[model samples]
Target: MDAGLLAWGRAVKRRGGKIPPLWYFTDAARLADPLPVIRRLPRGLCGVVFRHDTAPGRLALGRRIAALCRERRLYLVVAGDARLAATLHAGLHLRGGRRGVLRLPCLVTASVHNAVELARARRAGAMLLFISPVNATKSHAGAQVLGAAGWRRLARLAPRGHRAALGGIDGRSIRALGQGCAAAGAIEAFYFNV
Candidate 1:
């Protein structure tokens, strides 16, 4: 993990509350085994978005991750699975354009790639929005990048203290983003050298 990126993640926060500045987003293909990485994350004010959507035995894997988060005091959000999240008593992370309504009382987050998605997430009652493609990323190689300016534009549309920078976010890029984002989420940044 880059010390600069970690520092940036730790320092950025909303005015009213301290959202976990650093978010570890798990990928089934890239980060098959996330336990070791999760263990290495700095405790407190850090979050894990477990996104093993199609992997076999995902529920079992989520349970393990959830256990680690509890032990390490890391916030855990199971992506795309309300039942599993509820079972583990963890938060929920919705994918692109998904509605976020849930009866369970948990931290609800969503991914937004454009203005429409951003508006939808807010209406669905997502507490945080992970704005993506801030820069070119291997995960979405050909995807259009938001760059610094575009990201700021979309982030500005989000509710204050509820926007998180995602996609190709690293120490250098995040520094460029300044205070536009309340938090930052990454899959490769935390697992591999970026």
Candidate 2:
């Protein structure tokens, strides 16, 4: 974690409120080694969603990340890997429209790109939803993005109230969300030393 990020996390952690809905999604392509960043992140201020299931030795790495999360008082969610989620007693992350049920002790969250996906995630009992492309992003280069106004419209569709705006979201974009639009979740910006 960058010193600024750690300071930000620690400052936010001191709020003594509900866990911040902000999340950090891990991507191997974004950062070859994310452990240092993960280890340095502020606990209780951000959730870490491990999503490198296809990478070599992913299971072992996931286990290690889960353990680090536990030790640092950070919540971990295993993306698209129910078995790992279960084994680590962590939350499960599902892609948009990926249907699944989680047993007790495991919370469920999903990524949504539109109102339909938002509705699907809500109906699927997702406690939190990650809605993306608040601005142009590298991952989906040249793709249509949901600007602030569009995001606000789609945000109304989230009944569960725990949603984060991701994808090319910078400080300015977050301010543009206005009041109650959503929280901020990031991948490259949050974890890749960008």
Candidate 3:
């Protein structure tokens, strides 16, 4: 496990919330396998969001990943696949283009980029949200970065730290960012350097 990821997991356990504070986003394009990192995480220490959308074998892969998550007691959210999520008894993570919540059996989360998207999530009854590009990210290089101050403002509009800080957050940036979220997540942060 990355020291930062471990520390983030410990932080989540320290907090008196049911939601874990650390997350690892699986991007097939960026990472070969997340299981190695997931294995290092203490059971129930973090959640995994499998986001290789449009992969031909997504359902099969989701089932396999879901089994692993169940074994480790990790919360698993299938991005853009409410049906699959529901079938596996896992949570659902709405894609960025989908602005509102859909009636589903499991927890509903949304990807929020700006204040406008935040407002939509607030109204749509999402249980969680991920506000992204908090800093420059390899996935979306040169994209708009939401500095700490801006992130704080956006977080306030959400469900009070029920959201997460995605993008470039790692150990150094996380310490600098402070307690703005119930959780912090990233692809690079967990897979490699920030």
CA RMSD (A), model 2: 2.8
Q: Model 1, range 117-181, lDDT digits (tens) per residue?
A: 99887877788899998999887899999988988999999887898889998888888877757
Each candidate structure's TM-score, on Cα atoms with residue i matched to residue i, is 0.93, 0.86, 0.89
Task: Please give the clash total of every predicted structure, in order.
Answer: 0, 0, 0
lDDT of each: 0.84, 0.73, 0.74
Check candidate 1 and list the clashing pairs: none
Candidate 3 regions with alpha-carbon error over 4 angstroms: 97-102, 192-194
Tens-digit lDDT track for model 3 on 31-116?
A: 65666766655687788888878666777877888888989888888787767777778887776626323467666677788988
TM-score of 2: 0.86
Q: Candidate 1: worst 10 consecutive residues by lDDT? A: 10-19
Displacement of residue 36 (Cα, Å) in model 3 is 3.1
Better of 2 and 3 by TM-score: 3
Model 1 misses residue 139 by how many Å? 1.6
| RMSD (CA, angstroms), candidate 3 | 2.5
Q: What is the lDDT of residue 191 in candidate 2?
A: 57
Task: List candidate 2 stretches off by more than 4 Å.
Answer: 1-17, 101-104, 192-194
lDDT of 2 by residue, 63-146 (tens): 888889889988788887777788888888878847555553667878889888988878877777778788888767897889
